[model samples]
Target: MTKIFFLGECMVELRELDDATMGQSFAGDVYNSAVYMKRCYPKLAVAMITAIGRDRLSEKMLSRFNSEDLDTQFVFQHPSKVSGMYFIETDSAGERRFTYWRNDSAAKKVVQFLNDDVVEQLTSADMLFFSGIPLAIIEQDSRVAFWQKLEHLKLAGVKLVFDPNYRAQLWANKADAIEQFNKAFQISDIALPGIEDLNVLYGISSAAEAIDFFQQYQLEELVIKDGPKSVVTLTGTDLQSHKIIPVTNVVDTTSAGDAFNGVYLGARLSGRTVSEAVQLGAKAAGTVIQHPGAIAPLAAFKQAMSEAGL
Candidate 1:
């Protein structure tokens, strides 16, 4: 079985349930992807790498992971620190906004606590995945060390998949974000970036210009997602565009992109063609947008794939 590792934080998510209540769940960019991927490909070994506290919430999170059948050997536990938390506020249109309280999260200490055993586990993975948010949360020195480890892993023939899930609030300044994202692109074998995120981060103005910007990295594969519009893909010198699966009722767009990344990568790793993978991704995203929160139930994803004949 192929071993896939996702590196990031899983935060306690709070969303308004009613006029006087909030609903709680666990979610994060890569964590959401990990869940969907595990659901999509049960035979594959899916694992998460991050630091979490021994708090009750963290315990609940681990229990959920176990129920999902995700490998938890790589999850590190901190003695005193707790996991991060985020609150969601949706507009009348069901578009989501977030407020975070994660500066002191245990996941920020991942690099500080990585050991030789952890490095070996990462190096042995068939695919190692992470997002821009993980880069933003860790300390500067740890970021350097983390990237260095990634470089070593790349040389050892481990495939690297990077999702530039850029959030301006998570970054200190645009320049630093650009620098770090560029460095990540250089080391990545595959990149999943949203055109809107790229335009906002680099002032590229147009999708063509944004594609050109990423082309400088000479990645093996690239997927540029444009919300409700077409998705563009690049393989070597070839480029193609695929339309998004139309969503009739979008309840919340919280995890649409993450769902797309998960299904697309899962399909490709399962030997599906890029076009097939993209279509599966679009279908999954369309299904996810019709639900609330950062993770739709596993059954929802399975049903989406079945309905799409994937």
Candidate 2:
């Protein structure tokens, strides 16, 4: 089995259900992608490297991970801090607005638990996936330890996959986000970057411009995503364009990109060609956007994958 580790946070997610109620669940950027990928291909070893509290909410979060059948061996328990929570509001267009309360969340301390044994386990894994969220939240005091661990993974030849899921609010300034994103690209073997993230970080708008912007990196595989537009990729020096079949009714656009990242990487790791993988990823994202919330229902996702012959 090909083992992969996803390092990030999972928060208690609350979304308004009706005028008088709110629906609760567990989700975050990297965790959402990990869940979708693991569900599509259960044989892959998917471990989440994050920290949670010992409280009841944290326990429920643990149960959710268990229910997803994700490998929880790397989930650390924080001594005092509790898990984070966010409330989501969706508009008529299925666009989302978020309110977060994660300043002192347990995941911010995850770097503290990256001891020698954990490093060995990560080194042994085939790939490690993470996003800008972890890069933004890791405490300034613990960044040295975090960078050292990344260095270890690089030296051990672990395939580093990165997505710059940039949120301007999470970063103190654009320069710091740029610095971290630069380092991440330097070490990554595969990169999936959204045009929106690039627009925010580097003023990049289209996939063509994105390609020109990323030409400086030593990236082996680069996939540039433009919402509801053609997905573009650069394999070594060859660039290809894959059209995204549009979805007429958009219920929620929450995890569309994450869905693409998960299935695209999953398909590639399963020996599918880049073209096939991109089609399957488009299928995954299209199916996800037709549903509500970050995670679409399991049965629906499976049926969609089966229908697509993924």
Candidate 3:
């Protein structure tokens, strides 16, 4: 079985309702991908690498992970630390704004849990998936060590995948974000970045410019997703762009990119062609945006996959 390791943080989310009630859930970039990927490839070994506190919210999160069939052996539990939390509010168009209270999240100290044994376990994975936010959480020295371990795994033939979901608020400045993203790109075998994120990070206006920018690295595959327009992809020297099927309505756009990344990579790794994978990605993303939140119901996802002929 091929093993995939996703490294990131999962935060408890409070969604305010009309009746002045709050609904609790968990969400994060790579964690969203992990859930979908594990569902797509149930027999494959999928593990999430992160830390959670010894709290009820954390326990709920672990239960969800088990239900999702995601491996949690690599998850660290800290007594004093607390799990990160965020609150979300959405308007009529289902566009969301978030307020976070997560400074002392246990996942921030994730690097301290890394050692030779942990690195060995990570290296054993066939694929490693993560996002830029993980880099923002760790200390400078720990970040360097993390990068070194990734390089080691790459040399050992592990495929590195990254979604450069750049958040300006997470970094010191634009310059720092650029520098850190550059490091991840250097070690990455597959790059999945949103068109808007590329524009913000590198001032690259179009999908063509984004692909050209990432061409500087030794990346085996690169995908730049632009909502409702087209998804531009580069595999080796062959560049192809697939037009997105127009959606009649969009209920929410919260996790469109993550859904695309998950289904796209899942299909490709399962032997689908690039064009077929992009189509699946677009279909999955379109369906997700028509719903709410990051992880849509299992039935909704299955319907999307069926409609896409997956």
* Local accuracy by lDDT, each model: 0.88, 0.91, 0.85
Higher-ranked by TM-score: 1 or 2? 2
lDDT of 2 by residue, 1-310 (tens): 8988999999999998899998999889889889988988888988899999999999999999999999999999998998999998888888899999998799999999999888987898888999999999989898778878988998898999999999889888999999999989988889999999999889998999999988898899999999888889999978999988899889989999989998888888889999999999999999998998899999999999999995
Candidate 3: lDDT over CA atoms?
0.85
**Candidate 3, 1-310: lDDT as tens digits:** 8888889899897876568788788888888888877666677788889999999999999888889899999989987888899887777776778898888899988888888888887878889898988988777778888888888889888899999998777788989888989999988999998878888877888987887788789999998888689988899888998888867777767778878888788888888899999998888888887876777889888877787786
Give me the overall lDDT of model 1.
0.88
lDDT score of model 2?
Answer: 0.91
Q: After superposing candidate 3, which stretches have Cα over 4 Å from the reference? A: none
**What TM-score goes with each of the models?**
0.97, 0.98, 0.96
Question: What does candidate 1's lDDT look like per residue over 1-310, in tens digits?
Answer: 8989999999999998899998999999898888888888888899999989999999998888888888999888889988999999877677999999997799999887776667876788999999999998898878778888888889888999999989889888989898899999999999998877887888766558868788678689999888878788988877988877578898899989998998899988999988999998898888888888998876776887888886
How many pairs collide in each candidate, listed in order?
0, 0, 0
Q: lDDT score, residue 293, model 2?
A: 87
Clashing pairs in 2: none
Question: How good is model 1 by TM-score?
Answer: 0.97
